[model samples]
Target: MKRIVFSAMAACMIVSACATAQDGTGLSKKEKKAGWKQLFDGKTLTGWHQFHAKPGSTPAWKAVDGTLFLDTDAKASGASGGDLVTNEDYENFEFEYEWKISPNGNSGVMFGVNEDKKYGATYSTGPEMQVIDDAGHPDGKNKKHNSGELYDMIAAPKFYAKPVGEWNKAKIIKKDGKITLFLNGEKTAETTMGTPEWQELLNNSKFKTWKGFGEYPKGKIALQDHGDKVWYRNLKIRQL
Candidate 1:
């Protein structure tokens, strides 16, 4: 009788814990156990928005063999604005993705991008996670242009990216005022948000000329084309 009462109490506690732990996404206990929510369905652009292109135009974003690929062949002359964004807005969260780039290609993943298209381009508003082929891309002329860096503003400690044509893992965590970048399971760069040093870096960056740069509190996420052939997979995010 004592064992039965103990089991009943434990079951009630588990139910209460689950009820309180269910997030806004209504994920099951098993799904939330991994602490990540899939941003892409791998089959369609369901929870994403394709902007900067024409109203009905879709820019080279297609799912092939379970990988989301950006085929820039359709976009010649480097007519930019091949940025796709998430439907949700995030302030403090953890992001992870696997990417592969063609030789000499260029691309980026932008976060904190509060969409004010009337103001200017995406880079002017979002902080970019620089994505490029380290040894092959022209932007890869230095450590700042390499993968897993904070895109021209901060440089990674070392080149931890795999060669072109191979998948490389990357992660980003934004907790409170701290932001960290990771490459291939190693921490690369980190900075405190809204600090004088960070503001100074922004003022000196290419985005300096643009208005409202890194001034948003929270915003949607964006994937940039930048006239590069890049592929992304297993993109996931977890809110803190």
Candidate 2:
């Protein structure tokens, strides 16, 4: 009878451990084992700060209800807001996040972002994973500007973004100069940087004249604030 009681207790403890691992806002047991780390703690903006803002300035972004969201009201009122960027720079890493955009919203996730004051904007250095309301945003009409594309350089074969207000999963992987992007479990774009093909694409794009665009091998990740409202959660990254 004592053996039976001990076995039941052990089973209950195992179940509890699994439940803790499956918490929505944190890395799962499998993810932790795979070397994934949370970029957003889901309760605070500890790991991020506004781009180009003075140190210790209050960020225009907010963390509420397990989401990191842009305060459009603050931005429209000219209350000190800009793109948010990670404090730590990453190179050759895989990043994953979930996002939901407001109607007609436009924003992006940029990687390889150089934070020097010389660059007026994040896009001047980093390449963006386009994020917009495909059905309402004007930019969505162009495949290259749609969500999950490599911004203006490489267009996705088809639209894979969910409707506005619905969360969509996005993944970006860069390893040894090769980059691949996925939207909602579908591969959206792939490219190899520092190649002739990459140069040709850059030369043909709007960033052709922008010095240092997509040239850095290591830089911070950025969340763009394009005068729109958007919510991001479950931001996690693992270095390759």
Candidate 3:
């Protein structure tokens, strides 16, 4: 069944091509407006990819009551892995999404990913925009669990996360080697990518053991399911 579905999709892609404009991460006014485009239509997963295990099954992600929900209940049965990635690849861009985590839930949004199934997660190559329950999760005690942190690596500028079970806004801008994290309309963290300093940091971190992490110039965006219920919506992006 999965093969049949993927074959049909493959057939369609061969017949038609869909292109989206940029997210305008660091472009001038004219260039920004010219390339800025949306990735989600607010209703479907037309441009995303599920993990390798379910190559042909519909993603566990779904729209419920106008919001995107990542169901973890069904995941325990036979989930290949917890990464769901965008069908499109991006270089530099600004991405925004609203999310709500269940009490004690843990999840993440990653970018600058060079997706390869050999690795355990999207984080293997992409820097994650930490999504966690700051008031309930174990990592909450640490700054990395905050709303805008870089997930165990770089801390967010400040704590701005709402209580568990409430929706919070988050954004990530990646461009020209610089990365910025924003939460609920406030800037929280900023860092450089692919720099000697960053490499040094990775060299001393868990990612140090992972091969090809952040080696690609561009790749897909991804969502994680860490055995927690997570909700997302109003996801939009513009390239630069």
- Indicate which candidate wins on lDDT: 2
Per-candidate total of colliding backbone pairs: 0, 0, 7
Candidate 2's residue-wise lDDT over 6-118, tens digit each? 99999999987885575665877878878889999999999898888886676669998999999889755656778999999999999999999999999999999999989
RMSD, every candidate, angstroms: 5.8, 3.3, 13.2
Q: Which candidate, 1 or 3, has the higher TM-score?
A: 1
Point out the worst 10-residue segment of candidate 3 by lDDT: 18-27
Models sorted by TM-score, best on top? 2, 1, 3
Full-model lDDT for every candidate: 0.80, 0.91, 0.75
Backbone clashes in model 2: 0
Of the two candidates 2 and 3, the one with more favorable lDDT, higher being better, is: 2
Model 1 agreement with the true structure over 1-240: per-residue lDDT tens digits: 999999999999999787667454544565567677988777777788765446666557777776778877756634333688898989889998889988888888888887665845577788888888888877789647778899878887778988898999989898875789998998888988789988887786787777677778688888886877888888889998
Instruction: Please provide TM-scores, in order, for all candidate models, with all chains considered together.
Output: 0.82, 0.90, 0.79
**Pairs in steric clash, model 3:** 22-238, 22-239, 23-238, 23-239, 24-239, 24-240, 157-188
lDDT of candidate 3 over 1-240, digit per residue (tens): 999999999988855432222233322344345665555656676677775545456556775876778877665664344677888888888888889999998898887677566766677788788888887888788755566787767776678888889899998888887888889998877778778877876776667877777677688888887878898876778887
Q: List the candidate 3 regions with Cα displacement exceeding 4 Å.
A: 1-35, 76-81
Q: Give the lDDT of residue 42 in candidate 1.
A: 76
